[model samples]
Target: MALQDRPNEKPEASPADLVSSLAEASLALARAASEGEAYAALDMAAHRLAALSSGRVSICELGMSPNGRALILWQSSRGGLSIGEDSLFAEWYTRASRMGGEMTPARGHIWYGLLSADTLNDETGIRVAIFLKFDEMKEELAAHAYGLADIAAAVALRIRKQKAAALERRRFDGMYETTRAWLELGADIVWEASPEGILRCRRILNRRGDISRLVDGMDLRSLRIGGGGQSLLDFLEQQGSVRHMRAHLPEDAQGRMSTGETLYVSATARRSPDEDAPYIGTFTAIGRDAPSDGTRETATMLLQMRGARIREEQHRREAEAMLQGLRLLLSQDSSREKMSRLVGLVGECIGSSDACVAEKGLDGKVRILVPQQKSPGPGAAAALDFIAAGAPRGVVGVYDIDAAEGRNIADAFGLEGCQVAALALPLRGDAAFLVCVTRRAEGFAPADLDFADRFALLLRQALLLREEQSHLAQTAKMAALGQMSASIAHELRQPLNTISLAVQNLEFLLESLDFDREAAAKKTKRVLAQVERASDVIDRMRRFGRKSVGEHASLVLRNVIENVEAIMHHVLLRAGVRLEVEISPDVTAYADQLQLEQVIGNLLQNAVDAISGIGAKHERAEGLIKITASPSPDEKGMTVLRVEDSGPGFRPEIAERVLEPFFTTKSAEHGTGLGLAICDAIIRESGGRIEIGNHAAGGFVQIVLPRQPA
Candidate 1:
């Protein structure tokens, strides 16, 4: 029957009955196997409390959500009644509990009491809530409600602890299974030995039946067929570890014992300060082999091969890293910047803070290319001395400052104290480059020296290439200058002749005794203008002949075209070729100005030569050369300058070879064949190219360049 239907008079609970009911609840909870059974036992306890008080009592287990924002009614004594954190009863109970009052309720004659599970603490966020319904609020009934709630809290905490333990046990079981399977698959035999090198436990993982009994309880050291080397126990005692140590079993009296079989053992053990410790290791059986020296040699060779493979892999990775850094260094636009970054990259690769590149000149003086300073550091002097002594060419030398024999070498490199080391690699000739790297630690290994040698060789090749290019460019420039000398002489003679005439007129006017001052002044101004004009021609030629430093900047197309036209005008006039130039003043390109001038002049000269040849062949033919510049139609962000001539286009058979170095159509005295090749190189260096082709009008040579940004 429901408690509300009971007599109005509250029945007082006897102490013996309450104690018996508490004992029954505790007994039920102790025997509970799962959370459901535990909850059921708590429910019975709540009913017993209600029966004792003759009042309706409800027990609810409350837990915080993972986010701790709301209460969860995990379990309850009453059935078919839902209570949420938002409910009026729940809100009132929560507030009353915090306020430390038991009188607050949302319904008639209802009182709330909170029970603590101190063991659960905040980690579990679990507590018990009891609601009691009576005709009036009584202290005795409130006490009973709290007692039931306490029993429920204790049961819940016990269940949670049991669940946690079970989960941990399952996790460990999975780990043990995984580890056992891994060992069985990967190891031939796994073993453990006592401090005295006696076998404690050994597991053979072969597919064949167990043979472990044959060697059970035997001293592991007794299994080896000893020669003259240290025993396995000695290795373990000294190094605390052993790897790939060869051992063999004694030959059986039968024929099988005569055949040689070996075991490869590897082990690691713990060591204490005052005593030896037991060890665990692995052993793999090797096939039959010849006894003694042959077996040992084969094992040694195998180990060496393995070590070589590992070292080779390491070297490949390091080489790749160094190559990547080198590509970045080469991308730099300035020579000085590239040199500075080169030294930095070398230092990083060698794990040193001091590195430099020095050039040994023919005059026997060494100069530092990087750092851009005159003074040398500690190792710099020693490196220079080695270079001066003609250090073995193409070989990297390493010196340990701490060694007696190496002390002199160390002093040369400026290494003063012990432990520091220096590495020097000289280029192939007496007058060549030297690369030095110094570490303030132990000497460099053979592999490091090898890498440094290779890097130095690469630097040498690059320098040699740059020098050859410079020489070829200078040669081509001088050739062009020589070809233009005749035209240039005639060009200067015209102004000089005009100045001479003007001077003679002034002198005659002054000596005639009826000299006109205005006329004389006019003659004098004419002479001055002629002199200035002659000076301008010489200045343009001088600038064009100057060497290029390979710096790029925006260049006005019209200005460069005009400068080239001035140099080539007399040549064209003397050859009877009409030159037409069509270019806008605003059109610009990104390139070295002097190099661009050289390229344009070379093209104009070639056109003049081609048209002159055609004229010589056809006596009545008109020679015409046209130069035009504009933004390229086929490529974005590019400018095209075309030099077209009204001459017979290149011969089909020789067209492809026209730009090749040392490949020329003209006789030896007329052309050196480097003019077009040099022009192509200069254009390519500026991130551009030259295209040779024929249009309907005649042959055209186009200079394509990166256009200047607006």
Candidate 2:
């Protein structure tokens, strides 16, 4: 990093050579890396010059004295020279007394010569003093005194330049370093912008660097919103000259504006003699402060308020988005898969890149439901084991997992080593939902955790809904079995009777001496066919009887209707009615398969009973029930399912009541009245609606369900 040392050289002989040597010495001093090296070069030059003149040369600093004629040797080539302070003055007087123009001291006698400058005086006070013996060419040496003066002057100049450069460097470094320190201690931004709002320079002095660019262009609107209190634009426009103006700057998060920080700033429009220049300003940040005075207290309070407002705004937005996502989750059936994606979405809303949901089971096992990513390494097992132990049960909160207490949980989040914050939602009993989000430790403030708490509330609500739906689904399955019991018995009896008769016939054939092979074969085949029919009946009964697993998926209305018709065929036949199903191939919807079938079957059963009850009162009229499904009238994202029966229509006043729970018109033994009500709930919860009315020839029930999205 420093220049290489100058080439070393030997002393010269002639006066001309000595002058050249002095020039070369000056160049070597210039090449010196530091002041110490330069001094060494000067000493070397003195020694070389002493050798050339057959005299010892020394550099001296002239000192202030009473007589003003003293020399102090700073560096010497001759070590033992003792020249008295008055000796030089005595010599000068002797020369004057003799009246000689010039004279060198005699040989073998010690005398001193000074390197005197005619033009440049040494501001540094150093002079080159040469101690020598008298020589014949004394005037010659004195005649060329200017050359020695020039050499001394060159050394002085080099030293002076080096000192000046070092001083300038120190000054520059000190000023900028002090400025930087002050900025870090609470100076937010140093910015300069054009009067027309174009930014010329912008610097952020805080860890929150992303927001710096928000004010780069210095737009009046951004300033007004980002800085809340006084109208920044109006102030800037009205100011003839502004300095250290206190103003409000509001925070902007993805275009959602709210109150931000109060900043002390100097904004000035530079003015020359001829024209006004662009505005230059700085927004000084106010950091954490403990004030000893009222003024300081007020300033600190303002800064705290600024930070609080920004956090409150950000948390509100995140909470709202989180609640919306949870609503969407609960709107459908909540599943582990959907919940996983939802956790990630929630993380993004709250400015976290990593998030997950975990469940603690009764068997001391922790299940990560959402973000079922790769398992953690062995290093994380200890933390995960603690969670599985259910130590945090019922201790619900938004916690900084990176802190002392939360470290274990944070460590278990896997992969990303960012700061973690967790929200735990306790379900019934020992089961709990633990949701975690991760970011830099400072990224989340205490107030920011409020959003996580809101998220926990949403998760709790979703869990409650899921439990309620499960209970409702089980209750619906029970109600369906009670309603269809009699029909199921009647439906299975015929096949059972056929199997018994076929077995008796086969036995009779086998008892014959020469068994009628063809007859026995026919009877065996008949019996096998009957057994198969019985199995089918049992399978359909089991499908409708078991609990519904509330999972939503795409299903074609035509296919679902065919399955329902097959299951309910005997029920319709025993009711003395004909069931006709007409469904378009393209009528599809997103719904639970078993639940949808149950709804349609309930509707049809209600229709069958209504037709039978009506027939008992009216003269024997042919009973016909028609179930139809097609796309909605206007082709919205919906499928309309209609069930119409040739029965006494609903009493006009009771049309709406028929859809209400426990409002069936049928006899108590035959109806629980939950059929239509359950169907209505299913339709509405699927983001659709249900309608009940009297059509041209029957009581009609119409269902509109959300169609599968393209």
Candidate-wise lDDT, in order: 0.63, 0.58
Alpha carbon lDDT of residue 188, candidate 2?
56
TM-score against native, each model: 0.45, 0.47
Candidate 2's C-alpha runs over 4 A off are 1-391, 394-447, 614-620
lDDT of residue 253 for candidate 2: 36
| Inter-residue clash pairs, candidate 2 | 186-285, 187-285, 188-285, 226-249, 226-250, 227-248, 227-249, 227-250, 244-266
lDDT of 1: 0.63
Instruction: Point to the candidate with the largest lDDT.
Output: 1
Candidate 1 residue pairs that clash: 252-257, 378-414, 379-413, 382-412, 382-413
